[model samples]
Target: MNAQTDHASTVSGRQVARAALWLDLLHRQFPELIEELAPGRTGAPGRSAPPPDAAASARRSAADRADRDAALWNEQHGLRGAGGGSAPLRLHVSDALRDITDGVVELEEAIRDRLGLGRPPRADVPARLRRIAGLLASVADHPVLAEHVLAECRRMSRRCSAALGEAEQLVRVRGRCPWCDSVSLRAFPAWRAVLCVNPGCRCTEADCECRTSPGHRHTWAETSWSQLALDAGVDESELAVLVEAAEPADGSGSVSGSESVGGSGSAA
Candidate 1:
């Protein structure tokens, strides 16, 4: 029992750290995306020559320049989207970076999660063979019979095709709505955040479309992991456990350890 508990704890720690690594990477990148979307830097204007007169000069300049202003505007700023494609080029690069950043993150995180769960702790798996081993071990039976247990561990593998399928199929509908836990779409418990499923009423705002519907009852996407797990027929804790298992291993089969299961990390 001590070995089982100790081993599980060690594995759990490694898993948490790896999961944190991926999450921290994303947390850092999210701000970068926000920054990229921000307006370009605005520097102080350079000094210019003063006009010969104040109000009179302004009126005279306006009247005189009005005729050529349209042409001048085009020449000074370059044509719309025609600054040698520099602005658009930079924007494309920025957008590409954003997309790669988002994609690599999702891919790496998904891969890591899959690896972590492929093999649960030797003790956690539920099987007839595992039960037999535990019963034998409890009676101080021979450890040579551990071959059966080891074989069972080697044979079992995690199945996350469901999660992957869900990720691809799930449509995120944004809105302003409190979290609710109905058989219908729901939100996360603590934060009451939601991701709606009403494609006809989908939104892309910071808050989901729930707010647009006056007095509408719906769940928050950010707050609904439990419901997703329930609907998927898995415990929410399984998500955390899977994350732990995904940590990159060192030279050995073991990992460095990770945070405790079902941590407060927001699934967002």
Candidate 2:
């Protein structure tokens, strides 16, 4: 192949790999998502529950307060009855999963048509994902078509991730933000940055010249995380804990903010 063709092939191969990897991850995480959405059950016999730490207790309290607030708001706004509870949230999750499944099926049909392939066999989401990955691999030689397919794959992967509760997994930082002096610092592992989530913080404007931008924000990149720890008077060990907490619970590789369908998109 010519040099141009070689470059196109390389790009297409990389995109295909990334798209397939995301789909595979979603397939693996599907069971965990279902378990989380399902009602909690009693601990198994001979297996004791771990005692809640102070942090865990505090988190539970905060969550309870938030739930109560949500219930009050819903009741006042006629969004739900007096004691609606978490049923509505569960319904939304179900609808989101259904939509993602439908999109995947449609994409499968589209790809089969583009590749002059026959209808796919009736299968579950995991099986469909495997089939889609195989179809994407077949199209890698045609760069333009591969690009479109890869874009669709990325879009579906992102939707699947969000529906499965894998996106926006923010970890709270222990100390105040060094730049903003706000206690709203959070580590966004996908972006590999720690930032203040407070809206009124001026850190972004101080760093950049986008003073007039309404939603401007700033982050301390991985390179500067150590500096942030020092500035915030957080110990190195504590900083390490924050990093560990930011990692995916399943130990899967994080999908970086830059890897979305559009090159300029942010996963955060």
Candidate 3:
């Protein structure tokens, strides 16, 4: 598969595994919550009876069974209240859902940190959080809440997948520093500048005089593309316009600030 596809698949797999582990932990910690959320009747002991849709029955496969098992493990672990549920039991379930929602937030943060990119503004995050909170506050059973949480986790996973693809593209633009043979060299695609990894080297790809004393440079400074863009003869306003124009309205490829291009939009 292509790099983007591979990255996305890896991300989705990791997220699914993490989600499964967290769900298992949640199930163990609050068995009663699981029981309350079980698919069966209010007082039934097992999974709720399956609907008699022929299409659903026909579509059942090994994957479907696995999903059902996961759902059961995550949601169906508790016993229903005999009459009115105990206050403590209800409180525990509510707390668990809220805790799970918090965990989802943490997961998203961790993904962004790992990807090494600042989290761009997302219009979906607030709404997702609200939905999770609403699910927690409502009288939904554990299974229902677990399903919603899992779905939200997958949505975040998809978002991360997209981010990772963007990162891969940035890495390609930020080519290696030939002076020190360092792949960690920085690039500002907009400015068409690249920096050597050695701090003393201070040599940008656009100016290579520092190569004379590269042996003395040890640490590397983080490259700033905006400043470099100005150094390359583009004003801030022009850079902003270039950035906006280069970005596809369809959201396919992001305009990476560190792209390296030759004089005519060809690869250097």
- Candidate 1 lDDT over 86-169, as tens digits, reads 344334435545454444333333333433423222321123223332233222222322332222222121111111111112
lDDT of 2 at 31: 59
After superposition of all CA atoms, the RMSD between model 3 and the true structure is 20.9
Q: Model 2, range 1-268, lDDT digits (tens) per residue?
A: 6998889999888666656666666667665555545446478888978999999999977976787677667767867644346644554456667776787788788778778887887898778877887787787876777767655555655555676556665666667666667666666654557777777666544555325555656677778877887887666565545543432223465553311111121122
Q: How does candidate 2 score on lDDT?
A: 0.64
Candidate 2: worst-modelled 10 consecutive residues by lDDT: 258-267
Question: What's the CA error at residue 180 for candidate 3, in Å?
Answer: 15
Better of 1 and 2 by TM-score: 2
Q: What would the per-residue lDDT of candidate 3 be over residues 41-158, giving only the tens digit for each residue? A: 3535666666758776767555456654554454566443343323333344445545554656664444444445455335343443443333332212233333444555433333
How many Å off is the CA of 49 in candidate 1?
A: 20
CA RMSD of each candidate after superposition: 20.7, 13.4, 20.9
Model 1's alpha-carbon lDDT is 0.36
Off by over 4 Å in 2: 41-84, 167-198, 201-253, 256-268
- CA lDDT of each candidate? 0.36, 0.64, 0.40
Model 1 CA lDDT for position 4: 81
How do these models rank on lDDT, best leading? 2, 3, 1
lDDT of 1 at 38: 34
